[model samples]
Target: MTTPAHVAIIMDGNGRWAKARGLPRLAGHRAGVEALRQSVKTASRLGIEWLTVYAFSSENWSRPPSEVSDLLGLLKLFIRRDLAELHRSGVRVRVIGERDDLQPDIRLLLEEAESLTAGNGALNLVIAFNYGGRDEIVRAMRKIAADVEAGRTSSASITPQTVSEALDTNGIPDPDLVIRTSGEMRLSNFLLWQAAYSELIFLPCLWPDFTPEQFEEALRQFSVRERRFGGRNERDVVSSSA
Candidate 1:
């Protein structure tokens, strides 16, 4: 099977998973964290170079205060508890999102994770916390605007590559395959700009229940598809008729 160089996942259905089990939402979130740990291992073993997961979104703040608090607590716990193991496993941690207003402690922990794993190269683990795809594009635009205003570069000279470099994911390659669990069929404001041509796989299993087998299956699904971007290939002509 063809293994993608990069894979991104929208981990969804935690609350629904908890509801199905008659457990609290936090319980589901906790299980989701374990799923994440296992996913990291699976990705490494599969030789996937980059794995980006949608952990928390900017819009998630609209959730109930108690739930939000619980999520934040879980983030802290996960980082403090898992950072050592992640670093030792040769996973380079990268966090992308708006962090200017985050709690000082939370910000520090995120920075520490990136710094500690900066030298690791086995896998790239990107956590999209407090992230929104539109927000990321807006931020990139703002940076470009600022540069233009400062006479750093003419507006006409700015290209797609320039905008991409200004975004939080600068230097990171776009995902080759994007997966979403819990049967969701939308991107849900995740990696909007970067995933323009990524192959998508929507899984029926919820985030907490996602397994290595499912991950491997998604790769299997990706391997047979032909990606021609906007252009047409001979395969497309035959496949379209079939």
Candidate 2:
């Protein structure tokens, strides 16, 4: 089975999932963690090279204080409890987003996770916390501007590659498949710049309900479609599958 080299997911509807069950909102976030773990194992089994998930967004902080606290608490526990298992499983962990304002302990946890898994080669797992696509682009532009000001780079010589290297996902390949759960069609500022040509899959299942079977279905859907970057396809002469 030929799978896309990189896959990105916007895990949504955790709160809704809990509300539907008459459980507390935190109950939903906790269940979402389980879904995330299952996803990692499933993706690794399917031979996916890169898996990126939107764990938290820059806009998420605007939520209620208690909810934000619970989310961060879950993040802390995930790293503290699951980091060792991830290292043993050969998953390279990368956290993308701003960190300067993060709690000192959380910053250390992220750094520790990255350092421990830096040499692993199995599957790359990226957690986008406090990340926004537009913010990422602006951040990249600021970096490029600084380089140009320092006379290290010329503005006229800049290219797409130059800007890409400055973004939070500098070392990561752009996602070939971007999946948004809970039937959300919008990107929600997840990867605006990098998803220029990604094949998108929107599943109706909530994040907590996303299972391996659903994942396989998405991949199977991807396998049959022909990916032609913008230009006309040769198969168009007889038939087209888009």
Candidate 3:
């Protein structure tokens, strides 16, 4: 079977999903977590090497205090509950974002989870919590500038590869497929630099209701497409099944 080396998702419409059922927003968020668990299992079974999810954006801080607290609480619970199982299943967990804003306890848990699963080889699961693409780019640039100032590298050597190496996803491959639930067409500032040529699949299902079948459909669709990567002809594709 054809499998994407990496897949990224923008899990959206949780608020709407909750409202439609007369449930609180946090209820939908909780359901989203269950969906995420299923997605991880399905992706691993399907042989996907890497998966990234936009769990919380930098802009999410504007939400009400109660909601923010609930989200953070859920994150803590997730780490505590899933770390052992993930490690056992050979899934490596990594959080990519500005983690200084997180609570100290939460930070500690995240660090521990990462360390525990660092040697896993089944799948690399990246959760973008409090993450922003623009902020990531700026952070990368700042690191590069500091290195250059320290005479570690010359300005002429500051290529795209150099910038990519400084980013949080330094050792990870760029996503081959980007799926956004709730039918959103925009990137919403997620993986701006890395998703330049990714195959985008906009799903109509809300994040809480996303299913493995839907994910399989996305993969099947991706398998049929001829990825030219900006080239005009299908000949550029190394393998085209359809």
Candidate 4:
């Protein structure tokens, strides 16, 4: 099957998965981390060049303070424990989201991961932490306005590409396939602009239960999709006429 060049995941249902099993939500979060690792390995093995995962949203900060701390702690643990293995596996880690308000230690840890794995080329792993697609667009717009204010950019000359370049995912290509777990059919504030034409797959499995086989199944579904990118398929047109 033809593999997608880039795949983004809305890793949902961790808390629910844990609740269903009578385990703590933090346990679900930790299990999701293992699933994430499996996903990265699976994508790499399948020759997917880019994999983006929604780790945390800006709105997630509204959760209980203890829950927020637990999530942040899990992130720190993952970086510390798995970063070296990721580096050795040649994965380039990149984080997308606002960083100005992050705690100094967390901010430094994220930067270090990016800097350390920046040179790796095997597979690009993008973690969307403290991210919201609308917020990302707003931030990009602010950046563009800043440049225009300084006379370095012209408002009249701004194009979609100009706005895209201002985004945190500026150097990254738009995802070809977006897989959302736990049967969620919405983007839930994911890559709103970049995913204007992305093929979406909603799976029944929770994030914690996601496995290489599940990832492969998602890829299999994507392989047969007719991604015209806002255009009509010739075969479809012919079929309709017949």
- Tens-place lDDT per residue, model 2, 1-242, is 66988999999989999999999999999999999999999999999999999999999999999999999999999999999999999999999998888889888988999999999989999999889999999999999999999999999999999999999999899999999899989999999999998999999999999999999999998888788878777878557565
- What digit string (tens of lDDT, one per residue) describes model 1 on residues 169-197? 99999999999999989999999999999
lDDT computed for candidate 2: 0.94
> Which is the better candidate, 1 or 3, if ranked by TM-score?
1
How large is the C-alpha RMSD of every model relative to the true structure?
2.0, 2.3, 3.2, 1.3
- What lDDT tens digits, residue by residue, belong to model 3 across residues 130-231? 899999999999999999999999999889899889988889899999999998789999999999899999999999999999999999988987777777
TM-score between model 4 and native: 0.97
- Once model 3 is optimally superposed onto the true structure by TM-score, how far is the C-alpha of residue 142 displaced, in angstroms? 0.5
lDDT of 3 at 113: 87
Residue-wise lDDT of candidate 4 within 121-195, one digit each (tens)? 999999999999999999999999999999998999999999999999999999999999998799999999999
Once fitted onto the true fold, the runs of candidate 4 whose alpha carbons sit more than 4 angstroms away are 236-242
Better of 1 and 3 by lDDT: 1
Global CA lDDT of candidate 3, please?
Answer: 0.92
Residue 77 displacement (Å), model 4: 0.4
Error of 3 at 53 (Å): 0.9
Candidate 2: misplaced stretches above 4 Å?
A: 237-242
What lDDT does model 4 reach? 0.95
In model 1, where is the ten-residue run with the lowest total lDDT? 228-237
Candidate 4 Cα deviation (angstroms), residue 236:
4.6
- Is candidate 2 or 3 superior in TM-score? 2
Among residues 3 or more apart in sequence or in different chains, the pairs in candidate 4 whose N, CA or C atoms overlap within 3 Å are: none
